[model samples]
Target: MTSAIDIAALDPASRDAGAVAHYGDPVREQRLLEEKVGLVDRSHRTVIAVPGADRLTWLHSLTTQHLEKLQPGQGTELLILSPHGHIEHHAMVTEDGTTTWLDLEPGSQLLGHLERMRFFSQVEPADVTADWALLSLVGPGTDEALAALGVDRLDPPDALDVPGAKFAQGTQPPRPSTIYRVAAFGAGWVRRVENGADLLVPRADKDTIDVEKVGLWAYEAHRVAAKRPRHGFETDHRTLPAEAGFTAPAVHLEKGCYRGQETVARVHHLGRPPRKLVLLHLDGITTDELPVPGTPVTANDRTVGFVGTAVRHHELGQVALALVKNNVKDDTQLRVGESTAQMDS
Candidate 1:
């Protein structure tokens, strides 16, 4: 199966209206995604796999991280809630001692709820999004652009020697290593982020890995400047994985009993999380436009929260990434339609 890299038909000043939103300089591809190195593509997204031998104890009994001690060149992030915890199916897992992969977001039902929970379970799961593609790389010259296309070296030891410091420490960095097969691609992976990494190749060998691409408006403006909470952008249907900050590496909270672990352990011990993802800034004038994904986010006029990705940030110019209403007041002043945000501090 092979059909994933169409990022606006690979440039002609891209802007395919449905994906590749930039190529002809999204603020110089967000300043080469913040100072050098950029790639991106993300061939739509959605992989899946799962391969048996009880694929990590049947996905650690079914979701929200801590995959039965996930070893083999680790990688994490998981979710699939909705027994009440809400966010139904987020992804980015990885494995290779038989398969686990995952990637995500492309109209998820997580492969029909992993085929209705496979009764006796030896797991199967499938959906290999037309044999995978993904892409991404990113900034700080992403390990010198994967060592100038020679590939391998997927970050870990000193996680890229300090340019964004793998998301400035709040954890979840080191964990990428298992897929291999690089050059001209038939199987690859990279996948780390907040500054760089995430390849996953082989949708017909992703045009043999060249480099310098960057778009989805500079990876949604560095994933809303790294507050990263995507799953239909910051969720809805009642979010909660501690309201989008997916509890460090996509929720584990001491794991054990999946499916939404009793509303993620009663909202991690009784309460707090009626929405609160923040990082707005947006007072406007990056040539005005921004504010799109579900917009709304008011405050004095009432609404309270909405906008999810927004962008324009080459050095935080028009930012966004909201969810608000967890008592909305990180210095208030919200709004959104006419612009005016705040809370980015």
Candidate 2:
């Protein structure tokens, strides 16, 4: 009953963005993920492998992050951009001497581009999506779960290290889980995505583990509450890293030339993005439904921005992330659907 074919027995009848949407009870599932050691089946996110002697240097020249200095097991993010400085592809990158592993949402044409760019380089890129499954654990129980699986020590500074002391929970551990706290999701923060960790496991060994399957509903609420940005939801081809406040983690400005470096550098030094990412606190005084994505945000009856994702958090009532023109200050009121929302600092 643990096979991919049998996971449907768990009633993973719901689907979102090509993945498991939920297991029937979204609220309870969310509770498990937030308050307990919960498991999420991330079969939706594609897993990519780039291996070779020149993998580090080759990837370094193509992405926004600095990879040449990456030690084995250090996980970071990479943003591939269009020449004029728009987000083209996004990948969660990590390396282990021989291979650079990546996890990403849809729109993963990165393998093709990586392979095409391998003219004389000794790099090899492969999409190992079918070979592995990403099983993520959410909540404070991550440490205990890892320890239960034989990993007693955690990485310092970067607690999110998956390789340093990373291990699994089944008969044999494979890619190891990266456990880290989500600092953005603080107690009083208007936006908090709650803390969680993800374990990358081999597809064959995946079904043997016992973990609660959380749905996208819970994930959406947590992510919106933390104000963390996602690829397709909060960004697109026209997005700049600075606009989403992701530059601090996703970009190494001091790194050498890469695609879209000019725009990133110029924006970091001189200009601000035309639009800025903001946290929207929906009008919770009423019983109206929360606003949904693609809804127009109006200020003083003037269209100014668009809503990204909104969620009714367990603690934060109704919250969402929006991209509004820089001129639209947080003090102003914005309209979403039939309800009015305010910007939260």
Candidate 3:
């Protein structure tokens, strides 16, 4: 809606729904993110407010990450799961001393699940999607970009208080949650969601920031090349956290009881996920057609898995992120449509 229109205003030829599509030459735009700074639109995401006397404790009793001791402006991510341990929802979590904000993907029933789980904890779930918008700066000079806004030496991952800026709608920090740094472009996720730092602002102030805007294509290509697992693209109802490689920062192995802790532990100790996510080196020179998201991946002429994303990286050429059988070797040769794919390290 607003995000689509905003990107359209910036790049008239860009194709997008909520996330960025691209202006032109996605590869150049992707390189811009690495070499300099590029602004990204992230307004399509969902933000939920959970506030109550027992909200923190109740939330800690659930999800994978530890949130019981969250301080003001401290942020961490968490995953809500089925009792059986199937991946359900991944949320970007943060707090501002009052309401705990859970930023998540659109169409997630996490709020409904919370309502159902709210027996008497005094927790309330409110959709605040209309109240805020997310814009991210991708590149090495993150502090420089923030300095341009008169905000300097930002202690990222936490939140920043911007003075005299239109992005802040209230007294809350500019980032309601974690400012996930792009690990692919520079460091690791720690690793942040989709490899970028996120900033939240009132939708009314979306146009106030002064930053170089890059297309969605740059962001998507970087994600695929770096082998990041997106919400709907790499994971689903049947997905496991380990299957998508969300073990360390997203899930703590020693945390107390939660919905899927047992299964998560069981898989880590003895069992392995049926499939594992891997980076695929697509044969770009030989094959004209690249694998789409759901193109079956095969090894030894048998269906092992399917393609998640096939992005033509400027440096890596045509590459993809694929989910394949755990047994498939890292160097195994695979096939996706007419493209010959290989499981790369």
Candidate 4:
């Protein structure tokens, strides 16, 4: 799902340019992402478009969210699960009257699953990543930045019957991009996540917009601090939404049947997930290199879990997200590789 355009190259100060690791000043960038504003390149993500009259209802029946009443410009997240309740796919969804748009991490197989379940439905899911590039603006300066781009404010109107509203074609009045607390994108779509706004712009027009750029390190540090779990980083093949605090925003417990509703309901009413996610504060003095994901997390010399996303925060020196045995005591001392780790309070 990566774009041909190297978005990291957009930052003149970027180090580890291939992965957009940092802009030579990770702490400053992290501060910008937290207090001011920082733009992040996410063109490596994927986009999917599902068009047809039955798009919303079709998605509602197949995923973990209640999307049948979804309005145009409104945004929500959904998870596709295995019949046994394991999370298989996750996407941020929004409808634009004529089509349902899905924003997913790279390598998501949600599109193929949607197509296979189209037994006579009017929906047709197609990969549209080639036509779009994703970018994000984080921190308190988002509104000001959007205003500078001629997007006065984010107030998406109700879904109208415009045929090409998404891309603004055929003389249709330019439709506002989807907004959930934030709005962006002039020729594509936008969605807000926590304290940031993600903009998807046409590939040809992406470079036209001007903004201060940051690297992936800044974003990851903030995400780890916020306790937000990501798809690939926080999940494994046997992951359940409840294990990562994904049940509230990503699942609708009482709506209707989905691929994995049975397992979700059983876990909710009968028992707790075997593992639970926690934030860990690492003892930086114990190691020079930060622990990477998949590093074994041990309690009393016994492996208890594995690390997910680990980062050096601008404020909290070193932090990480990990999945540990639910039975582990809250006060237990833990170790991440050679460093002493404590549950972040």
Candidate 5:
């Protein structure tokens, strides 16, 4: 087997630290993410494959998405919750008849959970992260890039034998049948290519999609603007899908029993979630004076939530994502330490 390396594992000194630094600095990252299309190595995430006759049915019973209705070459977002309904992991699931791949954060507990679940079924789940390389192609030019790759439409849910090298359109509902997964990045698209193959394909004059290098800072800015939560930041084992706004497409309330179904259903139907995700626009802040993650956000001299992500927006100044208590209303004024910020409802 070929050895695989995580992009995050690369030494900062050896790699382009400037690019990653661009991700940490919001303004620079957003400019690159918005004005041009860029590529980021996502090999740090793991890919697990489920194969055999019972793969779809088995997964359907274990995840939040309705896998039974999923068509080959189609993909959907999934949240694996704990028995208490807290998020364990978020995944992008894709099916190709012979195999269903769950692409999740590297070292995520979902892989072990799925592995253990396999003992009760005949389906085979194998960690295939080493066999594939994942790349996140974000920005406005994403669709055109996929078009340059020969995928004109998203593969329908019912379609079989769809090419593995297919591209899906931007993240939108009832996503194009040819696209695999609808992503949250601004008009973003994800492309998965098997290892050992040339990812860059030949294109005509009008079809050429230039792969610009993007840093993590830019990706972070895009994520904050879209109000999408990250695993370790806004989401964790303590957070339920509802709290993180994963209740919609990421969680299937009608799906059969899974690890955290009861709690998710209970919170959705009977009780209010303890907290809600909110966007924060920091006031009177300078790029050098940005608040760090975990900085307590306070309102009326009380604690609400901590900053999850803080980005110095090129256009909007400083913005952040926070999981504040539900009582916090939109336009609520909150303070991060001594800095003032407003909650964007």
Candidate 6:
């Protein structure tokens, strides 16, 4: 789908206004968010389609979510891990009876892994990202804005039924759309508007709204505050899901078998993850001299772990998400660059 606005057109303004925040300068988009409830262009995310008689059974055997029980219109966060139990991709899995859809962040390599797995199974996998357009409506007044859009149902469809226009999910007629509720900042929600690429309509109702285009800066701050981890940053192929906080709702301990299950189960039962992801609030630090990703975290001259993401909070000062040794106490002082950081409660 063609974008209505070009990044180049807004580049100068974003730079001059210092609004190009978030990982990709989501400021212009954030502005639309503040003025009127904004529709975020999320077409960059990739979608993979799994279809066949064994679609549900096949995906159930692969992902971390309980795919076997998913009804239509229902979707849940899934983690695809490596054989060693390291995170490969974090996805939103939705089932529509005849088929299952895996929506993931771009560069997750989910399609490649799916294709590789097809050689061992009867499930048919295809890249369907081109067939859909995704959008996220965030900021304050999102619920009212959604209600104005004729979406009254607050609950998503069951995991196995075909997903359509509903609370978090909306699909243009004839084509299927699935929406997943993801963590966001103050009064924020993500909506995946699939199909109807031509019907690019922004929400028109405006009441009690303070929409601001959230740039990477704002998003980073919010994500850190929420203690939510990203794909490549807080997690990676070398990091176990348990270590990255995927053992909760994202990982299914009761689900039978899947890649990395043994390690995940072992860690869960032991209740001792090798590393822990912690929120760090650093004092005497500035954004211009923030610690780089993967910088080793040291406590008492002993290497503990590394930094994942760092951002200067508007109120909290310089903060970061660090992968640290599980043994570190909340008051433990860690050396990161020239600054010392303490784990925030």
- Per-candidate TM-score against the hidden true structure: 0.36, 0.81, 0.82, 0.85, 0.76, 0.72
- Compared with the true structure, the alpha-carbon lDDT of candidate 6 equals 0.60
Q: Which 10 consecutive positions of candidate 4 have the poorest summed lDDT?
A: 170-179
Per-residue CA lDDT of model 6 for 1-345, tens digit only, reads 222344335554322122233434444443444444544444455767788877776777787766665666445677888898888888766555566767676545788777877755668888766665344555455556656655453433212232221213222121112234322222222333221110112223112333333344554565576687877778745898878766554665556789989887777667778888899887764435778678888898898888888876666778899888788898887888778888974
Model-by-model lDDT, in order? 0.70, 0.67, 0.70, 0.76, 0.63, 0.60
- What would you estimate as the lDDT of candidate 3? 0.70
Model 1 root mean square deviation, Cα atoms: 16.8
Residue pairs of candidate 1 with colliding backbone atoms: 191-198
**Residue-level lDDT for 276 in candidate 2:** 87
Off by over 4 Å in 6: 1-39, 120-122, 156-212, 284-287
Best by TM-score: 4
Q: Give the lDDT of residue 57 in candidate 5.
A: 79
User: What CA root-mean-square deviation does each model show from the true structure?
Assistant: 16.8, 9.6, 9.6, 9.0, 9.3, 9.8
Which residue pairs come into collision in candidate 4? none
Candidate 6: worst 10 consecutive residues by lDDT? Answer: 193-202
Q: After superposition, how far is residue 305 of candidate 1 from its true place, in Å?
A: 13
Q: TM-score of predicted model 6?
A: 0.72
What digit string (tens of lDDT, one per residue) describes model 5 on residues 1-345? 123233235544322232243334345556766875666555556667778888877877777766776766456677776778788788877666577777776566666777777876878787765566455667666556556655453332232221121123322233212224322211222333211111211112212335655556666677788898876678645898878877664765555678888887677765478998888988754334767667888999999888887876778778899888998888787888768888885
What TM-score does prediction 5 earn? 0.76
Q: Better model by lDDT, 1 or 2?
A: 1
